[model samples]
Target: MISEFRSFIAKGNVVDLAVGIIIGGAFTGIVNSLVNDVVMPFVGVIVGGIDFSNYFLPLTSAVTADTLEAARAQGAVFAYGKFITVIINFLILAWIIFLMVKGVNRIRAMEEKKPAEASPAPPPADVQLLTEIRDLLKTRA
Candidate 1:
């Protein structure tokens, strides 16, 4: 059982999965930063400087809350902005991953498309015939 477990852990797929997970985590951070720091700011500027993360409504008409927290405190069913934020982040992450994978596949396809270099021709036909004749003569002797 221990040997089986060790073998499983040592498998190429396992190592690949581990590496992928680590890289994915790092990529997640990058995507998050891109969404929060770069994309969201631009989106806000284009949309009249309104913060998407702050756009929400208070469910309770009597209890008007200025912020999401205030709305939540007043028991309002708010959009929470976090949901949309996460959606945008996920879209961005997926797009980046798709592009990277596409680029890698393109490179792999190019490599595969290249014809293999031809090896040097074998010994001349006359040489082969002579060798065969010499072998036959020796066998007869």
Candidate 2:
């Protein structure tokens, strides 16, 4: 059973999946940083410096706090700005993955289109030598 488990774990597909998961986790952090630190700042500058993180709707009259965190502490609040940021992050990540898959598919297609190596030609025939050898063998027999 342990040997079977080891074999399953050692399979190429399993290892590849594990590697992909690890890389995806790291990539998520990079995308999040790109959205929050880089993209959002530029967007804010373009839109007159309005911070989207603070944009929310108060569900209750008691939720009058300016920040989402403060509003949440006071009462129920709908945090749409955070949702918007998350949507942007998802779009960026999806686009990157799509481009990567497209590139891989293109490379695979190019490889498939390449012509196979030609097989070597057979050696030239020697009819006279073959006949002489057959005659000599017949005489011996």
Candidate 3:
């Protein structure tokens, strides 16, 4: 059972999955930063400085705390703006993944279409004769 577990862990699929999970986690951080630090700010400026992260509907009178975190701390609040930002992040990530998958598929298709290695041509007559001579000498020895 231990050997089987080791074999499973050593498999290419497991290694690839681990690597993918690590990379995906890192990618999430990058996407979050892109949305929160760059895109959202730019969008806010473009849309007359209306910050989406701060935009939320108060479900209760006590939820008037200006920011999502504060509103959540106070009372129930509909944090739709944060949801919108998350949706945008997901779209961007999905689009990038789609593009990457498409490129990989295209490369795979091209490779599949390429001609296979041609069989090596037979050695020249003189080389073949030399090889035969060498083999004969070895047999005689």
Candidate 4:
């Protein structure tokens, strides 16, 4: 059972999955930073200086706090702005992945389109003659 487990863990797919998970975690952080730091700021500026993450509806009358965090601290709050931001992040990430896949597919298509290397041209006439002479000598022997 232990050997079976070891073999399973050592499979190519398992290793690939592990690598993918690690890379995906890192990519998520980068995408989050891109959304939070870069994209959101620009979006805010374009739509007037309003922080989207701070926008939320208070579900409880007790929650009068303006910011989403403070509102959540006070009582139940519907944080739709955060949801919107997350949706944007997902869209961006999806588009990027789609583009990467497209590029890879295009490269693969190009490679497929390329003709296989032609067989080496027939040996030069003199080389062919030498080969015939050698074969004749072998036959004679």
Q: Highest lDDT among the candidates is held by which one?
A: 4
**Candidate 3 backbone collisions, by pair:** none
lDDT of each: 0.87, 0.93, 0.92, 0.96
Q: Which stretches of candidate 4 lie over 4 Å from their true place?
A: 121-141
Model 1 / residue 108 / CA error / Å: 1.1
Top candidate by TM-score: 4
What are the runs in model 3 whose C-alpha is more than 4 Å off?
Answer: 113-118, 122-141
At residue 88, what lDDT does model 2 achieve?
88
TM-score of each: 0.78, 0.76, 0.75, 0.81
Question: What tens digits encode model 4's per-residue C-alpha lDDT throughout 22-139?
Answer: 9999999999999999999999999998789998989989999988888999999999999999999999999999999999999999999999999999999999999999999999
lDDT: which is higher, 1 or 2? 2
- Ranked by TM-score, top first: 4, 1, 2, 3
Kindly report which residue stretches of model 1 are placed more than 4 angstroms away from their true locations once superposed.
57-65, 69-77, 130-141
- Please write out the lDDT profile of model 1 over residues 6-121, one tens digit for every residue: 99999999999999999989989998999999999998899799787767866777657777777677776567576788899999988887999999999999999999999888
> Can you write out model 3's per-residue Cα lDDT over 29-122, one digit (the tens) per residue?
9989988998888888998998888778999887768788999999988888988899989988899899999999999999999999999999
lDDT score, candidate 4, position 83: 94
Model 1 scores a C-alpha lDDT of 0.87
Positional deviation of residue 107's Cα in model 3 after best superposition, in angstroms:
2.7
| Comparing 3 and 4 on lDDT, the stronger one | 4
RMSD in Å for all candidates: 3.4, 5.0, 4.3, 3.9
Please report, as a residue range, the 10-residue window in candidate 3 with the lowest summed lDDT: 59-68
Q: How close is candidate 1 to the true structure, as a TM-score?
A: 0.78
